[model samples]
Target chain A: EPEVTQTPSHQVTQMGQEVILRCVPISNHLYFYWYRQILGQKVEFLVSFYNNEISEKSEIFDDQFSVERPDGSNFTLKIRSTKLEDSAMYFCATRGQGRETQYFGPGTRLLVL
Target chain B: GESVGLHLPTLSVQEGDNSIINCAYSNSASDYFIWYKQESGKGPQFIIDIRSNMDKRQGQRVTVLLNKTVKHLSLQIAATQPGDSAVYFCAENIGTGGSYIPTFGRGTSLIVHP
Candidate 1:
């Protein structure tokens, strides 16, 4: 089965530095999303993207966060200034039309120290 | 609906036994729901889903039961195996104007012993 794929399985970055997490959603899916799971915590929604614009975002998705579909296949989340609290596992998900099932990618572990 | 802190509710079962995980959702307007399994060092994998109109839906070795009256959801696994050991989450799909975003609850950990 086709699955969502993400790059840089793990990343370590200094606080205050910029970080970009990349994902390639399933080719035919139209809706994409970003979610984060803090260690030992529930996964939280960050933002949802469709048609190259943000559909909805959580309060955690503040000024520092942004998402883009720079190409047909790539969806990325960029944090302008990483904070220690920003360290978490970031996951990318995609949903095709006509279905409620959203497939998730093996997450990118972001460690902002 | 959200799980905070370090302790996660855990269930332990013997291999080949059946396992059931339950969740109480907060959204009365949520019309769709999903179950996801996340192993250590991985993201949530879609297991099964059900709409508000359905009471139960079954997949290979798995079943999802929805009790809309009480806002409850449960995932049942038949013949559980070691590979089924993971954190299972229940999510509610809330949509408006044709857009849907899922909200996740703190997951319950399942441990299957050999």
Candidate 2:
């Protein structure tokens, strides 16, 4: 089964630095999303992307966050300035057209210090 | 519906036994639901789903039951194994006519003992 793929399985960055998390969804899927889970927390939606534009975003997805489909296969989330609270595991997901199932990637662990 | 805190409730079961995880959703408008299993170091994996119109749907070794009347949902695992030990979450979606995103439950940690 084809699955979503993410880069930098784990990352450590300094506070105030910029970080970008990357993902590659299943080749044929059309809807892509970014979600985050703080340690010992429920997974929360960050933003949903379709047709190169953001479909919806959560309140957590504030001014510091941005997402892009720079290429046919890559979806990325960038945080302009990191805060201590920004540390969490970020996951990417994709849902194909006509399919209700959304496949998730293993996730990228972001640690800010 | 109110957002829940991250302090997850947990359940323990022995290997080969059945395990049931329950959730009570507050939204009646939610017409779609999903169950996801997440490991210690991984993301949520899709397990099964049930539309509000259906009472039950079965996947490999897993069954999702929906009680729309009470806004309750449950996931039943048959012959549970150590591999089943993980945090399970219930997510609800109104779909908003294809406009709304899914709202996820706080999650429940399930531990299967050998």
Candidate 3:
């Protein structure tokens, strides 16, 4: 089974520092998404990307957050000026074209100190 | 916390027993629904999904039942094992024209004991 893979399984950064969480979606998947879950909270959608641009984003996806398909296989999420509340388990997911079964990665645990 | 389902519901079962986790969705327009499992320090793993058009779908050791009339969904795991101890979530969304931005339900913790 082709699965989504994320780099830097765990990251710790100081507040106000910038951080990039990297992910490589399934080789043939077309739609990519980013979601975060604070400890003991439900997973929340951050943004969705398709066709090399953002398709939609939630209110939590503010100016401090940005996503990019920097290459043919790499999708990245950059958080600028992180805050303590930014700490969460970030997940990257992808689905095939016209398919609703989205596969998720193992996630990167981001801790903003 | 005046946000959402502040406390997730929890279920405790013994090994070799069947586990049924239930969820009630708040959406009437949701056309697609999915069940995902999340272990202690990882992303959610897709377990199964059922469309509003269908009432039941079965997978390996797992079966999902959807009751659109009452807006309810349940996951039945057969012969639950200790490794099945994890949190399970039911998510719903209006799946039309290839959009999968789902509104997830508050997760339910399943503690399978030996």
Residue-by-residue lDDT tens digits, candidate 2, B1-114: 454222338999999999999988877777888888998898899899989889999999999998878778999999999999999999887554363466788899999999
User: Positional deviation of A47 in candidate 3, in angstroms?
Assistant: 0.3
Against the correct fold, how does model 3 do in TM-score?
0.94
User: Candidate 3 on B2-104: residue-level lDDT in tens?
Assistant: 1212134899999999999888876777778889999988788999999889999999999999887877788999999999999998888753456588767
Error (Å) of candidate 3 at residue A8 is 1.0
DockQ of each: 0.82, 0.69, 0.76
TM-scores of the candidates are 0.95, 0.95, 0.94
Give fnat, all candidates. 0.79, 0.66, 0.58
Q: Which stretches of candidate 3 lie over 4 Å from their true place?
A: B1-8, B95-97
Give the CAPRI rating of model 2.
medium
* Each model's backbone clash number: 0, 0, 0
lDDT of 1 by residue, A1-113 (tens): 89999988999999999999999999999999999999998898899888999998999999999999887779999999999999999999999987678899999999998
Order the candidate numbers by DockQ, best to worst.
1, 3, 2
Best by lDDT: 1
| Per-model TM-score (chain A alone) | 0.98, 0.98, 0.98
